[model samples]
Target: MMIVCAGLSAVVAGGAGAQHVAVSVQVSSDRQFVPLQSYVQGEVDGKLLFFCGLSDMGLHVFGQGAFPAKNFSRQIVMVDRATGAVTTGTTDHLPLATRQAMTVTAPTAVQYGSILYMYGGYGPDLENPGDYFTRALCTAIDLVQVKNALQASQPVPASAFTHTECVAGKVAGAGIVKLGDRFALICGADADGEYGSAPDPEYTNVVQIFDRNVSYVNPVETLDDGQGFFSPMHRRDVNVLPVRMPVDRAGFVVVCGAFESGIFLYENPLIWGEGDAVPYEDNEFIQHIGGYEGPIASLYSASHDRNHLLIFSGLSGYEYIDNEFVWNPAAPWTRQIVNLHVDGGVFARELVLGEMPWPLTNAKLVLENTLPKTTDGQVLVDQLPFGQPILLGRIYGGIAAEKQGSVSPTYASDAVLDVYVTVTPEGPVEVRPSAFSRVRGLHVSGGLSDLLQSDDLRLVTRPDVFRTSAVPPVQIQVVGTSPLQNPSEIKFTVESRASANNISQRVRLFNYDTQKWEQVDARTMPLSDTTIVVTISTDPARFIDDATGEMKALLQYNALAFTIAPIWQAGQDLTMWTIVP
Candidate 1:
């Protein structure tokens, strides 16, 4: 879901003595390589390796040689999580040609245990700067050895690269996810080279699958036929993100990404195994992230019941000026970090965590320590015997540009992003029960002390600005067990010193067919000099209209929202709703 609710922020009081479950970010000075993206990255034992990409943080001048040559006998950048140390290493034993192909940009890499397996990308032809060669090689780095070598201040161990295989046509830019023995290559493609216009490389409209057992067993340094795949997926790109659900194991979502070399935002997320892909108009979330022509990275939360995807620096918001798209070739990438929080079942919410100091995108989010998981891959919360924060790991470089439309020789990066996660005990769930009905998961603004203060109880509108076309209500959701949705009346008690007429209120039910809100009438009566009871009833003649199926769609909802804009402070609103059985 793009987003069910726009936002939800509260000044709630909790016994934990903290304000809100928040996200924090910090950055270290680069002092090494410049900003870089679309390169191969992997993490092991708290050490991160920034392998192969446009070596310089500027326009990739054609004849600048592969990263292996540039890094030859030189130390490769490595970030240590435990000590927050940024260092470099050298794989001096690898052959010159081998190193050159390995440093190719736009390659695909995935980390499992101590092994970092990488695939195809565009590398040097050794002749023209613009003309390039599509690399047809796969290399595996033994991360444990590299980490140990970095510790000893030694060149990358001779045994660092335990295996290398050559597999043609398995190009770069594919969204890869390892599922058991099979790894899927979600909609990504490659070309012969960006050699002129007519002979430009074509994209593949297929989701390719490769068997790990078959892929890794090839003779070291020998080329293989490498025939293992499942085809015919809609062409996708760097935007595909992994999300595991009970129904779909090892599932992934392809958000806003380029297809057919064109910038278009799909409406709904494209699932890995969904028959055919169809997206809607998404202007808020993914559409805002430029053409997605740049790099993007994602990491999921390990806390149970918390599903959040952190997307860092992928060219934010395609500029639209006066109803026209303002396309700029030199637009710099974003420094903003967006957090997508999934709550209330399929309902999802969006929040902006914070921003990085500089433009950063297309990087790595490596897990430093082991995360508890069930046999089914669900987050293993009960498995934990104690309560403590998990120091999951850190984020590494992407492309960091100096300015918009920056010239070449300055377009990459060498920096570290520090991250930490804290979790608390689950609090008691609040349930609203009345003589007629019961509502579960009703999150109110107050704690025990605030709820006890009668003076703080009143009816007022929500403080935050809710989107104009939202249905049901922002915080009030109704899950009625009974099929009788057409309640004869809904009663709510409120306290107000002003005239009852001055307390303007409207009740809107979600219309299923029109996808809009329809307002209904409510009658009011005085409860006391400063209190009142408002009753809203359904038209029985409307139920008769429900028989025609036309009005049935509109009257078939179990819950409705009441937007009450009282003169009093809305943050103090005290609301208790009841349905006439």
Candidate 2:
């Protein structure tokens, strides 16, 4: 389901002041022989090179028989982007060590030029049965030669592959990116035993840099805040992309990652530049969707001085219900697409673009039509033809969930989709306010009948708190002109000042289903004047009466009598509510 916010501009749209651009996905008819997920891939000369990944959805069990060797992808797969022809090569012809290291799941892989470097993956030991360990090996494959050998159904030449043993390559699910001549492997875990067995998995909190030949080039730099309480860099299975930094420099942005303290997902991102000695955390922006590793594409619009990172469907802590934002504590798998916009390489904001045709995780995008790009591969969107739909790329193998959340059944995705982007002329977006009325105890200090009718801060709405009996509940009614239609968000704003005697204030929403007032923890009282904005994500039909087209909110103020009696005052204009319709 595509949920378009009423006033949101088109994501990644090029041209100065362009506000409308359509981003969409078209499913291809071609299908793979078997499903694959959590794999490493490289694209060269219109051919995609696939290596080291799982053939099944994922391991559901915790320990012991978690990673079964039978589910490991044993063949080297290749796909022709133009013709949709697939070619497979068996790994049995290669050495056991090389085969085992190249076929493990969730290894850090990055393609520079034509060479694909894959490092650190976890799987069953080929030499020792039932024993699974994170491989401390790095394998580099010549994409051109490997693709030729696999197409002819010939044994993969040993010279086409090279393996290196390095202490830094002992982790799995890390993100690898090439900055200049050096490669950086960031944040993953080293599993010593079976999954979830004794000896818990250890997280590598350092970024390991290596040379083109897969040898350590720089001393490992740790990612921590010195206090050692909770570091944002302690993450894995994250989306790391090569981006254009300020002043046309090269850098990397590590997006939302998994398991903060082995439980929650990290919402913010960490950025590193080629000139900097260490990466810094971006705590200002919080990522609500696509919190797991998935297909991502980056574009830089030089004309507009903006960088756009397109994030596909993946696991997230939030979801949209009919276009309204709803928080999900479970961090369920979502099909929502998001665009992270960085203005002038500094300020950032997340825009909810549409969603994919289906839920995809651990997928990869291969650009079919190459556009102008920087040294680090960020597409120069300004160079793209305007007012035309450009074929961005083709999305490949990943895990497809039957439904959202962990309880749903899943399978490795064999589906391929062609992504497209179109930029159009700008148009004005509208935001309207709902008519509001005071239903209960609040006495209007101004002549205004509706507190939300205008944005006049001088118009005050006063509620008497000196009443002896439970100060008659101050109930406010928000009336909509029409019934709830498409997905949209309703924002309730309250600007009020409380006297020194005021202890606490509470806001509650009336639920029609349960016929109860549910307390909403939007903010804490500060005694002084403050403004609180609460976004309502619940279905409008559930809260708004169908017959009256009205929704009610109850405000309760608690105060302790002291030398000065408690008084509460609210700015009528600033306390107005608006909705994205």
Candidate 3:
């Protein structure tokens, strides 16, 4: 599933309107602001750096972290957007007392002097019975000390330097950013103060700013909303990241949470406004901001320039799907309807700005008078299937919801969808396979497409692994269908799943070469009434090999309704598969 045949591993090429080629960097973890199970990134020197905090769950083994405190061990392991080089370092030896005062669950980090200041999280302690009771405040780790010792083997920077002390709490949400010439960190409930007699503090609007151009750094209190500052504030799952839009010449911060009602933002931090606040349970704000029209759904706030704010993909129930809506700036909560077209030929579970591994999902819309287009004068389309190819269908699992019956906790078991296509001798033979469901969009690309385009295609396939190491020849069997009159080119595709709001599966293609399975290039085609065979033996070779894995092509599918006895159902039933071995 990782090594797809669509775009090159290091290089990618779209249809015709492709501009500059983009390379994908494997991000180890999510963002730094959240108390992730793994890594986080802190911004320094105008660049994002990566770090890892203590994670027992082993979620992000190579994840990153940002600075949370001044007195803890901090190091700079990566430089933002650097693809050529790799850097690694460690922290200085901690005093016996300092070591005893830290815990892994309470690790902290903060950005200072272009370095991430990391500190203790949940750890064992000698001061209290069992494990608890250390003052949850972490000191900053100096960047200069860590960077200077990069080439050295035992490179733990010295802790003799005095570090700043703030909330030694576990970091969550997005890392703080500077506004104009000021430094600020936007955070919600502090976990350290949440337990025991202290019980931690709840959601509070806190903005700490520092003096300008000072040689020695000392942050000043800029604003505080006392608990109700921004009530219905972000919960644990949501994150607040500051953004300075070009329109108002002011700073604005966006708050995105899970299952939340809408997106929220602060126009000007210096001024205070008594605005109404909406509440949400498990929210996922915005993944990437592409364009905006107005208030998309319930997420809306005042705007200095335009009215809408568009968002791409985010977290939801058992599956993650793409969400597109425009929020009005004046009303902030109302949505202005507009089409935020999806980019095609790319897939992803998560994506970041600039050179991310996948195309931007749920991308927030950027207001522009002119729409984007492809290199060949075609308009850029994100989710819809195109071309003359026939759709082959897909495979997936069934729902586990109580209303769906059975009542098993493991709802999505072994369910599948299969598509079949037939083509005349010469009509159209090119096909693209695309799938959509509650899981977003996954287009079929790579060698499958090449097998469809070229001749001498050999395909070795395994249904279990859903991959082939060799190229697959196009296989077309003539049946009762009429042969194409003036056969030009034939295409095929399969729409086997529902939209991003429902259960969908992935469909891939490969070629058979010599005596093995070779992954091939393929695309998702639009569904149609009449079926067409887009695949023919592009290359001749031996039979498909099942030694490596299952040889049958299988598509994951989920049945929405039951199959009754006497009374017939409206929709198509029974799993479909091509048995041409």
Candidate 4:
């Protein structure tokens, strides 16, 4: 008989002084209870169909003898949410390779309508005596038949699953997102050797696109910005969710993942839209919490043009202690639940809402409740009724750690948590007036001079007028106001006009922490007036000066022959700074 765990209540605050959204988790059992993690789960008619994953606590040990076949989750589990009835099925009818592929750990799985599409995972090869490898196979499971068989407590028919072999299926621990009719297999590894030994695993630093039938389309390699830096796409075991992009477009956001080099996790997020060739790495924002695979949910506020993403407790690189964000290089498991708000696909703000009841990791299944949602599965937050507790979704199955560290005793979590959100009534949105600040000093040709304090289009750095051998970047200093305390709260709008569309400018911000000038924005200026808004949302006070409260910026020019208009006021000039309340 299956045992159903009671509801565990956890109320997390939204934002600073925002209403408290009560979130809770209630464990439900449909049949005989079996603990599992890193499994593929899909919901059909209020029933959950769970496919291959790991049944052991924590992960496989790193040694010569790893990934024992006994630890593989071989049984198919089903849970009825309405009645709490649990059922199980077997994989004996599947072929050896298909069975091995179905039982492996951390395979990419995404449910599209009634079909559950599952891809490669790391496990033992049944064909070989003492070998384990990442399976190169994709399986399409019929959830309707699987649910029916499980509900009847009968064997699942072999026809319920269709297997295909392709090069795109050779990925494990990767994030999979459906872009319209195509599926993108994001960064992951294709490992064959034993854990922590011998040949290093190859990181697939490319997005493998697949059609609706899991056939290969093309691979989008990581962008080469000529910096020769390690691409952030070399990630695995991360969380990726379908997000509503600007103009209600479909996209996905790749959250933090592990092993940048020797177990250091990536702290930044990579965002990709539907039609983009590659995803954009948001270097300006550093995600401190929810850095690994866990329960994630998203809601879109069409009225406000913002997307709110709720990330539950998981592994993280930083933790808040004594009101200070402390960096943990070890990347330990955390109970921190973060709410990331993205406005117009440009700016992102992270708020630490609350924590989970305990430090849990690897619980990656979130079955959304029957709420009004868009076609891409984003909850329409604007249409929901206000001031009441709303059922968001249910989180099921992960590894529960005893402590928040790299080394800790763990167990397979049996908690089926019911996630709830209480939407509070918001006032009418206010459009804040753009605040402009004048440039005080200018540095050109290694000489410090005061720029003319005027609200006119003064030619400050014209290559054609000032016949110079090299175009020196004009450095400007602007004192920040008290309202501009953090980077996310401030927006820098630089307006400029060039003689030709080929003329480009690079904007760099001086980082006081690094003592180096970092390029923030670089774009080609058109013949008409152009405005570029740069927003930094990662660290609160990285670029600001502590003692003098001053910020420095540089404008580098590149063109055949062009002139840059100087700082203008009253929305008519080169530089303008605004703060969002």
Question: For each candidate, what TM-score against the reference?
Answer: 0.55, 0.68, 0.36, 0.67
Output the number of the lDDT-best candidate. Answer: 2
Instruction: Show where candidate 2 strays beyond 4 Å.
Output: 1-21, 31-33, 211-229, 425-581
Q: Write the per-residue lDDT of candidate 4 for residues 139-177, one digit (tens) a residue.
A: 888999988888777788777888778576688888887
lDDT of 3 by residue, 400-458 (tens): 12221112122221212221122111112222222111111122222333323223322
The ten-residue window of minimal lDDT in model 3 covers 568-577
What is the descending lDDT order? 2, 4, 1, 3
Clashes of each: 24, 1, 171, 11
RMSD value for candidate 1: 17.0
Could you give me the TM-score of model 2 versus the true structure? 0.68
User: What digit string (tens of lDDT, one per residue) describes model 1 on residues 512-562?
Assistant: 445565555332323233343455565422321222211211111111233
Q: Candidate 2's residue-wise lDDT over 171-287, tens digit each?
A: 887987766776678888888767867476777776776666445423245444443326677788888877777787777788878887677778788887766766788888788
Cα-based lDDT for every prediction: 0.44, 0.68, 0.28, 0.65
Query: Looking at model 2, which ten-residue stretch has the lowest summed lDDT?
Result: 1-10
Report how far residue 139 has shifted in candidate 1, in Å: 1.5
Lowest lDDT 10-residue stretch of candidate 4: 443-452
Task: Output the lDDT of residue 426, model 3.
Answer: 14
Candidate 3 deviant stretches above 4 angstroms: 1-52, 56-92, 96-112, 115-138, 167-174, 193-201, 212-219, 226-230, 234-238, 245-248, 258-581
